[model samples]
Target: MDTRELEGFLAQHAPFDSLDAKMLRSVATAATVITFPRGEQILDAFTDPTNAVFIILSGRVDIWNDADRLREAADESLSAGELFGFSAMLTERSVGPRAVAATPVTIARVPAAAVAPVFASRPGARFLAETLLSTRHQALAAPAYSSVEELITTAPLTVEPTTPVSEVARLMTERDSRYAVVPGPDHTFGMVTDSILRRRVLVEGLPPATPAREIMQPATATAVVGESAQEAQITLLDHGSDFLVVTDRAGELRGVVAPRDFAVSPSTAGVALNEQLRRAGTAEELDTLARQAPKMLADVLGRGLPSGRVIAVYSSIVDTIVRRAIQLTFQRHPDLSTEAFTWLALGSNGRREAVLSSDVDSAVAFVDGTPPDEITRYRAVFAEVDEMLVGAGLMSDDHGASARRTLFARTNADWRAQATRWLAAPTDGNGAMMTSLLVDGRPVHGDTGLPEVARVFSDLRRHPGTMRLLLQESLSSRARLHSMRQVLSRRNDTFDVKTYALVPVVNIGRWAALSVGSAALPTTERLRVAAGSAMLPRSQASTLIEVFETLQRLRLRYQLLQIREGIRPSDVLVLDRLSAIDRTVIAQAVREVSSIQRRMANVSNYVPTADWSSTDGL
Candidate 1:
């Protein structure tokens, strides 16, 4: 290419586009055109350090972080007229990213020496300043503390239960504290805060002479010192409390910590958002707060919380919102509140692996003798609750997995009978699907001791045919790892991470749990229990557990990124967007899932061959 043409190309790209004609001519004169075939490493931070920045003349380049670390996805894919290799030159750091040709590539390399003075110019300096600021902001964004113990600023002030409210307030004022802990009978404790005093004493017109215990709110939200700060954030969100009590290993109170104490923290933001959720008296108000959930997930995950832990935190918030919705509906229909029923969270929410985009898969189980009239009202209340959830950005399950659906909402006796019918003929009328959903049903609200579902699962050992059918269903969703290379190369192709990776592991976990008579809800715990019972080898279980987490992390990161970009979040992930390392990891995960499914195809050894009468308990 001509020097004039190269200079024009440089003028079309950033930072360099701001360069003067003289500087551009100098860069073009000093440039060397190099051709790298597909799959060639153009620049490596660890080896072959280059002092020149490459301007892509043609083809595509994928800029990636260290491949060994699996630290993050590809930084970007650069096409014609785009630049790479500047970060290493700008920072003079060896720890820079690797750039590879995703296609056969042609590039013009401009020496760092020639570009140095160009970058020092006015417009170039402005671009450099912005880049530096972004780097600095990311560094400062890391959470300052990792554990709940580190967040406690001071020792908790304790007062006797008999102390007057005024006396407790005086003590708090003297100590410059905003809270006082009041110990109760049997090592239980309650908290009296500034808000409590204002709400209970000033607004309610309670006497100043009232006992501290009278105004104290139960300190049900407590965290251990060793617990992760993310866990504390979830606890605060779950309880919608202003503060959480941190305790030592001996179960003694250590200190009181409030979200306000930590400035510009994810924990603080989560608590504040959840407080709004709790105080929302109307569905619209709750919906507005609930919409911030994706942002919360991003913030929490950005702070380096594990993917599984972040999902758990998200699910807890969803539970709080669902419970609050139920509360609001019951408040509106007091007649329905009199019914004895348990609200069941099914599917992903039931397993506590809920994503923000997941539909509300739920049901309701009533006590045997609830009046028919009351049952009608209960159904209406739950339907309203479903509408409220939808209003709050949670979609209802499209497959009729809701309390409003007559098939799902039933009395305890009905549930037992339904389970029996499903077990009797697993292929009849979506029996397999119903079993998969209800097997993991966990009570999210109301009377939670509904044993119909668990009792049915416990008796799964007696029905070997049903167990085999369930195992077959679990193996049905297999991934074709052989075609992953072709799939990953297609720029516009997308795949559902949940269906391809996550569901297979979840299905296998569920089947394994039934195999061992374990009722573990979380996928990880189910795999652990299966391993413990020798139903699955410990190594395979451990690998599958890791694979499950990897898929979940990728799914969540993709959805959150989409949400940030103002795009509607979903389960599908673009193949070309994945880093080379991520693609490799996912391919390995697919292979493992496929391998396990193949191994379990021989159902005899997979299921215990014990005599049914001898192992009746299991």
Candidate 2:
């Protein structure tokens, strides 16, 4: 490569631009020359190929490979100002644009080892690296949250100096937290974690002979105290710690802060809902306002609340919103008050498995002999509130909603008519199917005196009834899967992810809930509430929740990653991108769902298992 050509090229990119004439010459002098024929496939998506930075001289290049082929060709053609194959030059992988000459091309190759000097000399190099690291940088919208700190919680956790590791572990367990900071003899603190036990005692074969100080992370990494939850989250992310200890002005630890504490922070969902409940005037306003439940759910999950508390906090928030929404609706349509009523929370919201952006699955009810005006009030309020939610970007379930038909109505007569028509008239043909969606509903607001509704649902379920019919509808759709527990992909390709692996768990949960008139829709809680009493084994119930949550987390993480990548967030996850561990977990989750579905099928439909795994495993 000519020294002048190298000087001109180095001067163009910022990190490189800062180089003096002498250094530029040095770079150009040391630069190796690599030439290629007019065409080449440089890298695969999953693997990196090059070990040097590529600078184009006389020829052009194309980027992409069939495997890591981000593009079939140079998705964006590079000219003199543009650097191509830089990732290959910078790192030990096949990365970046596959520099294929549009015609015969001349290029400069800078060894990977030398790239760091350019970075060290010019901070701009760091920016360039990150920019190239992500291809679709233009599409990455600013984060919705105000700051990154809003999601981390590296607050220091401290305990009394006398607290032993056993007691520390007990506190951590009771709090469902992982790490604890122990009180120090001085102002400095000692810490304890399960990792210490595993690494020191178990792995090193050492006894509990050493004090916790031998292994504790220094408190220096945690928040100083009184910082916002956002700052706490940042401290945690920066420190990779889960628990934080809040201190007072004097620097004495006052309380322990964990992910859950941050999630239920006063300024966010819990506080906002509390404030709204006081100010809300009409039921329609309340319901419309409740759309923030998803926002709160996002915040809860964003703060990295653990699974159980995440579910618990989110459920409580949704329940609060539902009640508040209904209360405001009634205020606006006072005539609905004539009859005792219940606002049933169906589907995920009912069972406490609510997530951000889930839909509204609910119906209204009144005592059997409701007056016509009450029905009008209830219907009108629901209509207004439902439309408000749609306008606010909160979706309603697909079966139907308050906007269409007479879905939100008053009276047990109305519900009875709907349920009876589905079971008896069966004209809808999708009766058992639709009923399953409705069956998991638990009253959220109004005169939640809904035992009658539960009884009616349970009776129909036990009869020559909807239980088997619902089971068949759900299972038949999932039958003929290629693997016993795996989602059967399509004949051409396998996208049977949600249909086979996820829905079955949810449907079985619905059936179980209906069988017991469970007060919840979420499979886990329904199973929990119904355990022993509903003839459900506690262990099985717990396992089912784990299965459900695993699927839910996978789906959630997939969506979050898409959002990060500037890809459209969709339920259709690209399985190839998942880690090997994640893929295995997903497969296991799917299989668990399958096993539970199989058990439910055999039990409900009296189908004899050809093999023993279904029954014996259960």
Candidate 2 lDDT over residue span 1-618, tens digit each: 577777787788656777777767777777876666776543332255466666676666664422334445445566554555443343333333334566666677776566546643324434543453232321111112223233233444455655555556667666544567767655565556667756766787754445556657665545554455545544442233445555655767655554333332322223334234334565445555554444444555665655444554455555655555555555666645634766677666666666544576777777778777656656667766565545444457555634223554547776776676676634375676557656666666655454344556665434544455554665665522345434334432233445656667676556556555455655666656655422245566677778777777776656556555766445555656778897787677766666655655555544432221122333
Model 2 compared with the native: what TM-score? 0.47
Model 2 alpha-carbon miss at residue 462, Å: 5.0
Model 1: clashing residue pairs?
none
TM-score of each: 0.63, 0.47
Worst 10 residues of 1 by lDDT: 133-142
Taking every candidate in turn, the Cα RMSD to the unseen true structure, in Å, is 16.5, 17.7
* lDDT against the true structure, each candidate: 0.76, 0.54
Shift in Å, residue 194, candidate 1? 11
- List the lowest-lDDT window of 10 residues for candidate 2: 137-146
